[model samples]
Target: MERTVYEEETYVGLVVRESKISVNSSLEQDDNQLDFDLKIIAENTGDMLIIASYSNNTMGENEAVNESVDISNLFKANIAFRYFNGMVFSCSVYDFYDQMPLEAKIEFTMTKRISSSVTNKDKWEMFCVFLDETRSTWSDAGMVTTSYSLDQVSCYSEHLTSFSVLMKVTTDNVSVENSETLSLMSTVCV
Candidate 1:
């Protein structure tokens, strides 16, 4: 068996959705637009991770401080999503180092197929898996890689016939090391 370690230093704050118009009709004319309005609500669930490292110092009799360091660790965060039955279609990650009010965003899309009977109030479930870089006996050495998965369920509601979804991952941190230190990985269905 192989041991896979999760990188928690990456954080996903929230997923947001927007609406885009495919077609429109006016006086003897037709047009289309891609627009989205952010909605705020509760009652959704997702997962997140926080990876960090820290150092400790001890005072010695020689009037000097002894420092101790530990390897980076992972912390998991539970996230709630408003919709269910959606998978991670795409993803992008950005990093800002040594900057105040640090922030980043992950944008992805999702789709689900189900019967024509689902509603907004109906609950659904989805799964997301993130893989970190590591070595495996099955492959050669000196390979740095990462990947993630998104799973979603359908809410068969009578009010809606079809649903197309987009997901956004945003984060804000006061402590960041450097910009251009971010990476992204994604999985999509053809």
Candidate 2:
């Protein structure tokens, strides 16, 4: 999620929260190289989030967004979890010809905030979770979090659904970026 990157960035943009009535940025066919790499975080939950992007070549088109949602009252929130973040993803990709969502590989990275106590590696207990549509429940995304780097934890994603990168916390105070402030344009790398 830093400015420095070493991969071929096929599609990169503002990660937004996906809902029933969806509006997302579509990755297009292009030959030019976009030279920007980005990283963002969840405001309230204190979870620093990063995105690892890819191009779904077999797919005619795919829809996704990195969105953050903050609630004023956790007592009334729908998700019954001890830890949850605004870093949610809507991963509904359509077949170029069939209009169905296909399973694909995705990943997330979290950078350690140097000055913040919450980001302390010793005190943090974090995990990634995805929402199950039929049961309306949040379950573990079954992804692996590896601290291969000294300052980041990247998790692997394997399916199409809504995803959240969460962290355990003892306080209710948190901040999230407003949806209106985000731009959906994507960045590609050479």
TM-score (all chains, Cα) for each model: 0.17, 0.39
Q: Cα RMSDs of all predictions?
A: 25.3, 18.8
lDDT of each: 0.20, 0.36
For model 1, residues 1-190, the per-residue Cα lDDT tens digits are 1112222322212221212111111110011111212111212222211111111112211121111111122111221222222211112111122212212222122223422333344332232222122421111121111222233212111111112221122133312222112211112321
Q: What are the runs in model 1 whose C-alpha is more than 4 Å off?
A: 1-90, 93-103, 107-109, 114-125, 135-190
Model 2, residue 97: distance off in Å is: 2.0
Expressed as tens digits, the lDDT of each residue in 1-190 for candidate 2 is 2222223344434333322122213222133111112221112222222222323222121111112223222322212123222234444433333344434555555343222434333333445566666656555646555432333345665565555445533333222232212222222221
Q: How close is candidate 2 to the true structure, as a TM-score?
A: 0.39
TM-score top scorer: 2
TM-score of 1: 0.17
lDDT agreement of model 2 with the native? 0.36
Native-to-model Cα distance after best TM-score fit, residue 13 in candidate 1, in Å:
23
